[model samples]
Target chain A: MKRKTDVAGEAQSEGGLAFHPLDQFQVQPLFGHGPIEWYTITNVTLWLALAAVAIIFVFVVGSSARKMIPTRLQSVGEVAYSFVHNMVEDVAGHDGAKYFPLIMTLFVFILFANMLGLLPGSFTPTTHIAVTAVLGFGVFLFVTLLGLYKHGLHFLGLFWMSDAPLVLRPIIAVIEVISYFVRPVSHSIRLAGNIMAGHAVMKVFAAFAPMILISGIGVLVTPVSILAITAIYALEVLVAFIQAYVFTILTCVYLKDALHPGH
Target chain B: MTTTTTTTEAAAEVAHETAKAGMPQLDFSTFPNQIFWLVVTLLVIYFVLSRIALPRIGGVLAQRAGAITSDLSAAEELKQKAIAAEKAYNDALVKARAEAAKIVAEAKTGIQQDLAVATAKADAEIAAKSAESEKAISEIRAGAVEAVKEVAQNTAKELVAALGGSDDAKAVAAAVSARLKG
Candidate 1:
């Protein structure tokens, strides 16, 4: 078993008073205490499964009736449906609507997972680079494959911009190809970093709350810490939804490029 | 100083272990599990959304659009019918007015013909009465002339007898006839 010396060092540095803010992100085996195997059901697995179940309940069970005059639950289902639908169609054009189901699934899963992480003691799967990398790379692979299948070798034209001057054309194409390859890295990191930062900041502020009882001047610091936690917590809620939206729209934009690869 | 060095070594050992257990997200060991579960979850969600939820919602939207389109077409048909009915009504009114004028003209001509026939019959009756009255007046004048002749003969015979002269009936007759002829 690995010893958590950094947590101990952090405790000693803070005079053995505060908990480590990043400890919440640690993945642990949910069952037997052992090293996490590939098949071991960790907290990440549990929370991701729960997010999937929540999505099913909201989209499947909520919309099962398919009422014309929608019930509240049905309205929620319809709103999410149209939101992703319009995004896919508008960004990707009419042909892009064919991939609505995939885009909708991605959006709802990330959205629910991010929101569930805000609950006390819940694991956020989106905070893991592994999970986000799969999603980002999945989109990257799917779009690239689709473009190749649809356009054949001509799909490489997406990297070649003819609008620029002849001398700058090759230079611009190199940059475009690099950026295209870097999309999955940036895409995964953006979501994971934003979520990890927000949660970490909140934990840091929460660590300051106990200082009020520990020191003479803690009274002044406690209110400020509490206020900061409250403010950042609110911001995290917005970030959670925004990050999901950003990921889904980027997927659509990538899909548009695949369908119509040009300058 | 020896004690401080030992304490520092102990802290370093603890920090090393802690670093090993650091951010689980960066830990390579858990990546496989996270990726596995993520794939499973995404596949399941995609299946539900594509096969179940999306189709149901799409059906409702299509039904709504169809309902609206049918209603609009029905309304358009009714509007055309109303316009046709209004045109028919206007056409009937114009035809009725023309028929009424024709009847009035026919009535006036019939009345004029009847008046002309009545005036002609009244003029014919007046002419016949005037002719009959003229014949009667001529008959009366002839009878008076004959009576005057006979009386003149008788008076001449009486005057001749009174003067002691023979009266000749045939001569008086012949003389009277000659005087009337002249």
Candidate 2:
């Protein structure tokens, strides 16, 4: 008794967005009553929200009872803190400590979000270009403003080194400017692409889990697939931390360049 | 040319209609969407983490690292103490062994002195006993020789007195005695 079009699969989802292979990255608009049109919220927002909440909870509870003798949770918090602190110091030096709050927050939030997304039914916020771009642009702007504020017109030296010879200055400047503009694109794409690809692979593998579970040969594959899943899960966890670390470290490097721009 | 233009126009119109029908009006091109989310994220990160959560975590982490470092330093100090004690023990053992050898040498020297004194005393006693025995034997032989000479002298005197009444008897006695003695 179904409709003729439904049987033929001619119809689509009510949203009208096609079910493309990578539809998860597309932005959908949200409608509201007011003049201020609400942007449609996606699973990415929820993932980030959950990550922030978890980070807040862990830190808050961990240090609630400030004691001379710390608990295991406190030690974990300390290790995370020192790790980011040392990284900042190593990349950005003493001045980098000023941005510790930002860097650490970014690292922990992204890490938690990435790891959380690996969970079944969870969405990875970084998988979306919008989220990654925003983060990348924030860093970009912050570094740019910081550079201008710190060195004024001298910031142009980042593009064309004043110390370079006149003959090669033009070529070097062109290359430097292109590289500079490409930073945010690469940064954003690196995170988004990695997350999206990993998730897609996981999803594809997971889809086969059911089909393989039915056939007799499927039984043999169950253990292998399970092991692969487990290993992939662990790798995702590592990737989460590494990507976050890479992002933070890159930010630190940018901040360093901003603080002292030249060659 | 006119037919081609007309056909192109019709095709464009149909394509537009199909596109309008197929896709929803998703405003992904707008800047407000990105800006709004960015601001929200910034506010969330700044306030929630910086104001509330970060401080707590920072404090906890600081305390934990401090405790760890202190413990490590304390362990290092203890290890140094242990090493120093071991060195001191070894030194004392070496000193004790040297002291023991010195004591043994001193005892050996004292024993050697005692042995020398004992040997000297025994040698002197033996020489004294030998000299005393030689004196005793010489005295005993002198006494025996003196007694034999006295007995021979007495027998000759008695034989001379008993056998000889004249010169002829003296000569015959002399001859008999010589023959018997010989």
Candidate 3:
């Protein structure tokens, strides 16, 4: 109880624990204290750098040998390559295979970012709306442009339901257009939200882990919280992988819609 | 939500020092910075993958597929060759068996011809020897009959002298011959 009151000021308005769960999401300069300028190298930059290095190590250096029989890292690279490749080819259609590099870029970046963020004390780039919104909106714009370029004015036919009765056609088109615009928002939020929720829940449970040292309830609360933290952390690793996969597959689906924009 | 607690600049500063982390995600001030870094990261990743990584991997994958396909076709070719070789061997074997049978038949006919000639020659030799033996027996019988006639004449002369009756050799022989014939 003494420790609780002593450190409660650190947790601020959150009375129970000495730490805030959302604090992990904060952006700060990597070198020292400074305002987070657009050009400043921050923790986000550091982790992003780490993600880049990881991609290079696995994809670039790993497959450098290009052996008929692949090494472990090469095998891993090939599996990831083909997984995204097949996904694009399957979902985005045969013509969509041309965009393999773009889809692959998104998938690899998001995947690496998500996986790296699982390290202790690490910042999750995907957890931020700015980051995901960029990805989501990026896909949205790319798909829209692709549709417009390929189908021209007919691309607008995506929202037009010719099958619907003439009276309800405009209403349905309005609904479709709204849904179409919402793709980026939902696409970005889904990844960011899933990752944020899991991490926050883990932080909350982790804060309770010190209960054993502070209160009589420490005996039970502390162990349970620790166990909960472990379980959630494991779940977070899964969420990390799943979120990356979800974001990529959705990109492919949107690409498919762009390529063959009919009914 | 927690940022609402900051009623003054001092409180916000204190919050920064303390748990003011608030919804750091919602802190609009960091948006530009985050977006900037995120763009740089994405662009870096995009280039690294598209230019360096993806092509290398895709090439390796395509190369591997090509190798596997070629290997399979080679195996199929080898299998076909093996099948053809086996057929040739069987054909040769069948031809050799037929040739062996033909040689055996030719040898059997030659042996039969030789055997028939030998059998005919042996039968002719046996017939010639039988004719010669019959001629010799006839000659020996004629000589014995002459000796018996001479003995009968001598014996008839001795008996006539001893009995003081007849002494003619010709008459004795004629009478002995007539009795033997009867």
Candidate 4:
């Protein structure tokens, strides 16, 4: 006795459409089997790949032409190289040279992936929570292992309230542990959610233009949609670069804490 | 009639309620499924690109930079050689001009000496000719006087011989010789 739309289509929530635009983030299992769960092929993946190739190509080619009198290409490459190199040195300290390769790689990969998602018809891989989570988890795992290896069980001092008053130690320790556990989740979700929300909203707004134009009821709607898309797109571009920087910088900070759990 | 109207109204209300109910719910779980595969795909890409493709590209870039530096150095050497050659050529040109000026000055000195000798010889010849002309004029006058004396003596001798008087001719010749000596 259900109507046609009810039987085959998405059920409209009393709140609105059954699928809030954000509902796309819900992680549903594909076949309900295997260690390798399936997810939708969103545009995020496409962007990440684009970003990776672009960054690699630009920097590699730019630096490849090493001249005593450097060309514009070489300068740009050196700037990126020096920036990341300095970041590692500052956070990881003088001994950070060892981690240069890893930090540099992370910066480049994240930056390129983020930028790649900005292009039309492309997906950003970093926009997926799974992908970001894996990356964050890897960093966490690496730094934690490094800390434990270097300091033995004393690395646990990173999470303990060692310097706090005796009475307040337990309370601070609980907070510290919880914060430590939230590291990967926050790192991954912060990036993926920000990018996904921006793109989804942009897509929804874009969908409105055609609807308004075809309906022919309002002239202002089309222009408004266009302006909104432009503004959001611009913002997304900034977000892409910032997020990459933040991710790499945070990784450096985590490494610093692992290497020296002083504070 | 009133009951019938009420029954129709009730049926209409039921239809409106069904219409307002909208569509059924979708299995909202599909999104996570999509995200999971996306991770796998991304991982595979990262491994293949980072491990394989990126290294090759990096190698090419390194080679290209080396090539550029070498080319620049080679060009610099060539430029230096050209500058050296230019300097050498200018020096040679200056030296050649100096040598040429020296030869011209030497030739001028030789010509001046020849001119001085020729002028002196011409002046000496001119003086000698003027002296010789003066001697020729003097000799012509003396020869004229001697011829006149001889003529006179021959006539006097012819008259004396005709008269048979050799003493008269000797006296006349002695008088003429004394006058010529004086």
Model number with the top TM-score = 3
DockQ of each two-chain model: 0.36, 0.16, 0.44, 0.07
The digit string of per-residue lDDT tens for model 1 on B1-182 reads 99999999988977756655677677887788888888888998889889998898888767777988999999999999999999999999999999999999999999999999998998999889999999999999898988988898788778777888777777877777788779
Which one is best on DockQ? 3
Per-residue lDDT tens digits for candidate 2, residues A58-150, read 666776676667677766666787898899898888987888888887788778878887777775667767677888988999999999999
TM-score of chain B of each: 0.47, 0.57, 0.72, 0.58
lDDT for each residue of candidate 2 in B56-155, tens digit (9 for 90 to 100) = 7676556667889999999999999999999999999999999999999999999999999999999999999999999999999888766765565556
Estimate TM-scores for all models. 0.72, 0.67, 0.84, 0.57
Q: lDDT of candidate 4 vs native?
A: 0.69
lDDT of 3 by residue, B1-182 (tens): 55565557666666555543357888877889989988988898889899988999999999999999999999999999999999999999999999999999999999999999999999999889988998998888888887877787678778877898777767877887886567
- Superposed by TM-score, candidate 3 places the C-alpha of residue A4 at a distance from the truth, in angstroms, of 14
Regions of candidate 3 where Cα sits further than 4 Å from its true position: A1-19, A165-168, A215-223, B1-21, B130-182
Total backbone clashes of model 2? Answer: 1
- lDDT tens digits by residue: candidate 4, A1-263: 25535632543332132233433333322344333234344343334445555765676555565555557866666666668778988987777657766776777777776676677656566666656777789889988899999889888888777778999988888898899889978987888778887878887777556545355543777788889999999999999888888988899998998888768
Judge candidate 2 at residue A82 and give its lDDT: 80
C-alpha lDDT values of all predictions: 0.89, 0.72, 0.89, 0.69
Clashing pairs in 2: A78-B61
TM-score of chain A of 3: 0.93
The candidate, 1 or 2, that scores higher on TM-score is 1
True contacts kept of each: 0.78, 0.24, 0.87, 0.15
Q: What are the candidates' C-alpha RMSDs?
A: 8.6, 8.0, 4.9, 10.9
The CAPRI-style docking tier of model 4 reads incorrect
